[model samples]
Target: MNHNEYMMKKLYEEIIERVGVGIHAVNQEGKTIIYNKKMREMEAMDKEDVLHKDVRDVFRFQENQSSTLLKSLQNGEEIVNVKQTYFNNRGVEITTVNNTFPLTMDGEISAAVEIATDVTRMERLMRQNLRQTKTDFTFNHIIGKSSEIKEVIALAKRATRTNSNVLIIGETGTGKELFAQSIHAESDRSDSPFITQNCAALPDTLIEGILFGTTKGAFTGAIDSPGLFEQAQGGTILLDELNSLNISLQAKLLRVLQERKVRRIGGSKEIPIDVRVIATVNEDPIDAISNNRLRKDLYYRLAVVTLFIPPLRERYEDIPVLIKEFIQKYNELFKLNVKSVSNVVLQFFEAQSWPGNVRELEHVIEASMNLVNYEQVIEFDHLPYQYRKSEVKMAASSPEFTESMEETMGLTDQLALFEKQTIEHYLHKHHSHITNTAIALGISRQSLQYRMKRLDIRVQKI
Candidate 1:
């Protein structure tokens, strides 16, 4: 080799060695002829291992990039900003954002040079930022992903954005609170106060004072405290079981709804408010008006954007997911190692009509987690008895309810009974279509089969 040739080769090697980007030169046959130090580090490979190796043998592209990457390599076209992350043996994932530009010699593609820039930290930060920016109300926390639930969420989100009044109607235990909270969370008011008041929990006078502020001298010992509507200023006020509010109070609420202002007790001046209103009623507002529990005018104002949350029995498909969340919740709270439910027990839960809905199921799982002594998997015996009280012969079931064995029986028996009753109820609800039945039951087809064996429940094949 001449002196100039030697110096030229040394300069080329220096450039490849010092560059931070992973640079690789592959021959026309797709064999690695030159692999830089950075390239070997990115691949977690030794210099000897990658040198003279087939490019296809060691370098793996993403599943969807086969055609574009291979064709570009053959045709000498440049592909840029191809994003990918590769995991190494040490469990470290390296993200590469790069361009693959082919080298042509004498007007024909001969070799290709890939310039890969390490972007692991950047990619991780981007993902973290995306997660942080995610709306506080998530599809996951909302429970059901059914089409009905999806439509409701989308409409609720739109309503929240516009500051419209929302009236949520659902049977008791149908997760009215969840929907109310989600709407508030997804709205611009998420960072503001989310005040909740159950109208039925107070007497008419007390309820009026709670919803609207009272003057210090209005009544004996009145301290001029602001009520829920004032407290929720610049945010949202959730009126739970709004139908329970009496006729007179409804008139006051309707005035506020129309005027967007409130007058303190014994005070002539009206104080303006920017509070958004969200009310939930277990009964239909129309029925409430007919029965004189709710005023027709107030109902129309509150129902500007109405949402109905279906009963637990109606959306039985969500039972299993809710149960699992409750199980994980209790496991964390009680510091238990319980992992899952047995097929029979799961089937029992899936099939039952959860009249009490998510709240009822959560209570049952929490009780069962505290009851089970040895098994990691919750069996039929781990459930409560209200579930199966009708089925158990009274005398024979007494020994199972002994107080000495309360830890052994009370919680578990209740859960089991609840699970059994729920399964039987849903089976009847679905008219016993095993597929729809299994879906409502929230278990695998196989698990349902085993449960049928244990419960001695029969259903004619659809």
Candidate 2:
């Protein structure tokens, strides 16, 4: 070869090395002929290790799975964007998306060339997300066995069988997202992405761009990237707090649902989507429409299959079970061995209204557990001040009991008793932080310490 041919050949080699993609080729014998630099890095092998080596001997392929490259060469066909997982020379797992083509010379197959993009990270992330979706939002998360919740969960399970849109209606903290996630995990698209976007979290000005995506220069700081809809292709996209979106944005979302396509903000091209939409409303859909917070058109579109999650107050029978679940959770979390709540405390938990739903009940248990140390039973007195203040008063009848009758001790003793309870509760609330607790009690650090000693309240762990 002349100098010009050698130079041209050298230039081609350099271009292939820096192309940022993995390229590999093999002869009809299935021996590696060309392995680019990117391919070596992706496979964690050197050129010397791969070149002239049989793919079957170098890579670990399962006995059942077909090799896309060999398949293409055998059929003289092209396989596009196919994923392959195999162990490399160093026994490291590798994943790649490949476009394999059969090279032809004189109307006969000569070799096979494979263009690959390493997707090991993407694959792992997708699997991690799938695990999280299943783990964090399974039927087990319901943590209740009441008929109201059971009925709703049954409906949700049926909703998962179709690709139709779902609208979950419930009050706040009633586990709307939990049902959405459970449905996604049980659906046909379980292997794909499960993205959640709260309509309230999106800015009004950029809601369009964020939901539909934006092209570079569409607006200041706009990026040429896939939006939530595109990113959740072949999976589920959960629109949380659906009523928080304005009517105009709701209209755009309805259009996307109706057309099954999305156009980026300020862009003319439309991209088709195959995503299962699950929207949540933290209020009655009828109330939202009447209040002008939600559009009726959007509601009708999203509520193809509507589900209502009953609040924890309505599931009174589930309180004891919920309390047990929370205790077990805190046992694992706080590294304690708390076993149960006292019978009276259980009665109190069941009687009161949990306006915040199951979440409020959980919080009460968590806070009460923090006050315990190696204790097996949680009592009413062990609960947070808000809960026990009433319970203690009702039980004790009054703060008149003292070590002695002690004439003229009535009002002063009563005031001291109130002060003692207030200081102790504030200390625990602030996690034994002297400065913060003092601030909360509107007293100085020295005064708090003096009061603690005078009231015989022991100092807890800092």
Candidate 3:
């Protein structure tokens, strides 16, 4: 070859080897011809082991029938963005998004070239992102003027003065993390890292390593890595759905809380850490303890300061305010000028049960805004399909049989009656399971029991 052709070929090979993606090519006979540096790194294979080898012999496909390179070569076709996951000869699993096309010469297929992007690190990053939270919430951002919520806010503010571990109990989507973040923002540790992990987001085996650092040779593919505790040094780490952790891990967590130190998964030495932990539970703490999902001793340690966020249903007066705030938020987010909701839509929203709590309310408003035109009020027609159909489920006015009874009762008594009826409906619907009923009512089991007693209601066994 001439010097210019040789230089050009050398440059092309160097560029392909150093590229970010894994590049592999096979001859028409399915022999491994060109495997670049990135490909070797992605598969954890040595160049000497893969070069000039049979492609099928070196890369062990989970299913031979679904191999992209083989299929592209056999059919003389191109495949784009096919997700392939398989183990190499060393049993190391590799996952990649692959694009394979048949190389041609003189209108005849000569080989197949495959370009793959390793998604292992990307998947880990996505999981970490799911567990991470960023909040700009403080006491003033809590968005409620009701007396009940104001009382809760007062208690939360009191918690900011101390550095004790806090346990926040609330139903799903009741903004437990918001309260956690607000406390962190107001506390002495506000300047430090505010890391978060959802305890239920991972399996038990993985969750342990993620919370406590993993040591080298701890297990297969395990490296010496700092866990969330180390990452949140001198700061606060929020463990959402803390009750989802099993009892054994809970014991380890208890030790961490008691000693203020954490030992890596396979290490003998303990590392001292100064981190305030804030844990959240969607179920009633009492029920969680009874169900063995939470260790009583650990609960005592974590609940040194407890905060209970009341649900949207209990603080129904906050609905209108929350709706207005959501409207303003979507106006800025979607860049539309939605003014207000129709009176009929507002009445329906206030009367309907929000099973998903505040998050659900936000979704409803955002969806309605998407359907409404700019500078127009959101009418019932603009509501989501399910919400529009919910109007048919609303009950008609009271019958004449209760008219005389309603006259004698004061407003407080009438409100109490309404509350009792709502609780009863949820209790019966959930077959009287305290946990389920309390969750449906968006209150803790203890609070639900108190309401039941105050209203003179009895739960019959199903």
Candidate 4:
């Protein structure tokens, strides 16, 4: 070869190696000819492992039916932007978006080239960014006027004044995350990154790496990476359902909290991090402790500024305001002009126990709005099937009854039966909790116990 030809070949090889994407090419005979540097990095393979080998032999194509390069070479076709996920021979999973096409010369198939973009990091970063954006919530966005809710909001607002870790306790669908975000937004570190993770969403090994980071060579295919704690430095990290984390991992988290430092998995150095942590638990902390789902030390560390949000049933006075706000929200979202809910519908909403709390109420309103047919008012029929069934049950259990019941009983007898049914309904709704059932019934615990004894009500624990 001439000197210029040698330099030109060198330049082509350099350009292929320097390109951002991973490039692999196979000759017309389907033998691997080019495996560039980026391709080696993405696949965690060396050039010696792939170069000059048959493409089918290198990838073990007999094991995978979706080899785009082989298909492109065999069919002389092009495939673009196809996402593929596969496990390598080492059992490490790799995900990539690929473009494969036949290299044509003089109207004849000469070779096939495959370009792959590793999207694993990009996808993880995108999810982290999405979690960060959820910190847009603030105190102003919290929708409630009842005294109990106001009290919780007041406590949460006080919590934002300091950098102490916080623990928010509430039942499912009670907007615990909303309170957490509001606290973060109101805090001194409001301008910094706010990251969130659901502890239950991932297995322990993955969740640990995601929370504490991982060092390169921590395990096979583990890259040196910053976890959520590092990503949330100088800001806040909200760990939802913190009790869902295993005890061993909880111990590690507690160490991080106490020391304000995190050590990456399989690394020796401890890195300092300055972040406010806010954790949430759907169940009662006592229950979590008793069930061994949460560590007592971790609980104490996290509950430095504990905030307990009342359930919707306990804050019944907020129902009308919440309904109005939800209606306005759905009106804007659905592009409808629903002005109000019928009085009967409002009564049904107030009387029914909202086990799913505020979230359920929002969903019910959204469903009703969808079924309203441009009507200004949401009627009984517009409610969800569950709510409709509730309305029927309420009507059937009311003091006024059907002709069949009247034919069998007198007024006094009917009144006694209705009273018994009401007590039983409240008991079942409150999960047979005597105190809560009494509170809902507008009676003292002693009075409720007396009624239960007199009425032969057998309270069974749920």
Candidate 5:
């Protein structure tokens, strides 16, 4: 061959060797002639085995009757840009988008060039993006923004990126489920199901069946069923209050986590499962383990990463924000144009210890919005009588408590009580400086002044 022709052949060979697309040349007899480096790599095959192999023997799929590429090849027509799924030698699934065109020589088909692009990674990413787009997630989906809540969110974000187990601990109404959802939403497996089950909510036998699945007729009325773990395959299953589960159940769960497989109850077959576990508990699992409520080994397995959420009292600054959000939500829900809570009501909200945390605050707002008049500011009267009585009792029970001063009282009695107490406390504490008081309280000076009037807390200096 001439040097120019040799150089041209060398250039084409290099392109086939280095190009990202898997290239294969098949003669008119449908036997592979040229299998490039990429094709070999994608199929996990060596050059020798692929060079003389039949294309059909190396690739299999359900027959497509109207397949353009196959039809074109048979009719000596050119085909291009056809996508198909092909199996490799070891039966691993590979997705390839390709173009197949008949090679023409002397006005006759001599061979065909099949250019296949492996799109498995691209397809997986697209699926992930699509799932994220469809996910219904928002800040309100979580309950609080306290420093503790923020820390939990940060930890959850980090944990989701990895395949580690996570344990979230908090009291009831403290949004343990919210942490679970946030982790799932931030994970690579976010596209998968984020299933949850309260261990305390199920019986031991049923819980076992629900988690590890069951075969048809395993027991009376126990038909074929996939458990929470199976349903959460390629995703996460949040076992809330995992410490509450029985020790026997913990053993099964530990096995699932360690072996990455689960046997259906009353069934001999062990099914493989791939799922991320993010469990939550109100009690410390370590404490549970110490008390024998949870197995020590299982606790260690689940506690690969531990996160804690502080009670609302620790994050009191978030109370006002949470109250505002709750009010707005209930306002729309109850069809009330409730403007805002009076300073008297707000002070009562902030001062009282919330045993139920954000949940208690939400209920208070929801109850007030339903009972308040349209476009009217909610005052102590709009608040539940129990809450108002409790606040009064708490205020009276304090050292500087004033009592029996307003018998047969009206709005003026409440105004006088607030102005004399709440405002007096801040003014005295900050030397009558609104800016200093607001700063100490972590609120805007304007908001502090607003509270002054709403509570009828007068600036004796102003």
Candidate 6:
């Protein structure tokens, strides 16, 4: 090869390796021939494991479709922005969008190349939002040590003793549903079904039909259906955000609660339901009534057995326990060794009134942990962009971070530090098995060996 051509080839290869997207290419026979670093990271596979292997064998799906690369190679079709799911050899589910193009040589298709963008985390999060609660998750999932929370739990535990309806009032994200599930799990109806419906999630027309069964001719394209109440007949139904219901629906719900009977939308028969009721409201009951968001009479009936959950601000003592729990949780989840939060972060967290309560704090920590690669402590820089405002405000008051920590190394030195720590962590995890560590780190074994040598990580001797 000439000097110019060789230089150009090297530059192109470097660009492919450094690109921020996954790239994989397959030969005409559908064997993976080229897999870049990003591709290895995305699929959690080494090039050695993928190269020369048939694409069909590396990934599978129940839809019985060929891999995108194979499809492109066989049909000479250019597939763009197609979102699909694949089960890798390890049975890990992956979701991604891909652009695939068939490469031709001498007017014949010779290979196919795919550019992939991983969306597995996003799609799973969306699914978790939409999926129904199973209720096997019991009181153990509730994390708190404060007497306020303990008293609430005690009251909820008492509520489970009887079949009386329950009203849980709390700020949003204060673990109302956890209490509901805990009650259901401990109730006499534990063997029966437990169902939940968000009353505020639907409109008047749809929610009425959903909560109260609909006849075939009840509305346009309506079919005979049993409502959520009937579905929970032998168990419990949790109506979330009860105050968000329209006044008319509130009256209807009140009637159902009072009468213990439900009449279908268009039917004359009143069906007797033997379901236990548990409902939640995300506001103070008195204000909800004054604002016309809730009916006083209905509130009186639902609050027959009331349990109030204190918000995070009201229970500041639980912050340290929660932080430790979350750190341990995410350490197991993300496969890392995050030991704790820095003192400043902990102080800032305790000082702030978490408007979103425990859920918000958990998310902040989760996002911060995602940024923590090799750090033992989650520093202020690891806080998400949304929380940076709070840091700026805090700096004005105390100037903690600016004075306490200063950059001690250049970019190259810092990069080396991170690499050394990361390699050492993975080495410990994999018992210094070079191939396993390399696969876990998304690098070829030889590359990992070279990096270890340069970083002075001596555990490869094991």
| Number of the top TM-score candidate | 4
> Clash pairs of candidate 6?
none
Question: Which numbered prediction scores highest in lDDT against the true structure?
Answer: 4
Clashing pairs in 5: none
Task: Sum up the clashes in candidate 5.
Answer: 0
Runs of candidate 2 with Cα error greater than 4 angstroms are: 1-135, 390-462
lDDT of 2 by residue, 235-316 (tens): 9989999999988899999999999999988688999999999999999899999999999999999999999988765666
401-447: candidate 4 lDDT, tens digit per residue? 78788788754455456657888999999999999988998754655
Candidate 2 at residue 10, lDDT?
A: 99
The C-alpha RMSD of each candidate to the native structure, in angstroms, is 23.0, 13.6, 13.4, 12.5, 21.8, 21.5
Q: With candidate 3 superimposed using the best TM-score fit, by how many Å does residue 379's alpha carbon deviate from the native? A: 1.1
Please tell me which model should have the higher lDDT, number 4 or number 6: 4
Clashing pairs in 2: none
TM-score of 2: 0.57
> Which scores higher on TM-score, 5 or 6?
6
lDDT scores for all predictions?
0.72, 0.80, 0.82, 0.83, 0.72, 0.81
Root mean square deviation (Cα) for candidate 6: 21.5
Candidate 5 lDDT by residue in tens digits, 239-317? 8888789988888889989999989987998889988888887877668878888888877888899888766655666
Stretches > 4 Å off in candidate 6: 1-133, 397-462
Candidates by lDDT, descending order: 4, 3, 6, 2, 1, 5
TM, every model: 0.56, 0.57, 0.64, 0.68, 0.58, 0.59
- How accurate locally is residue 32 in candidate 2, as Cα lDDT from 0 to 100? 89
Give a tens-digit lDDT track for model 3, residues 1-462: 999999999999999989978989988888888999989999999988888888778877775446688789989999876667887888887777788999889988889999987756534743574455445788777888878789888999999999999999998989998999999999988888788888887788778888897776665445567888987888889999999987899999999999999999999989999999999999999999999999999999989999888887677668889988999999998998877787667656655567799999999999988887765688878889987664433221323226666678643454455667777889899999888998887665655775687679899799
Tens digits of lDDT, candidate 1, 160-238: 6778899999878777877888888878888777777788876786667667877755653243557667777888888
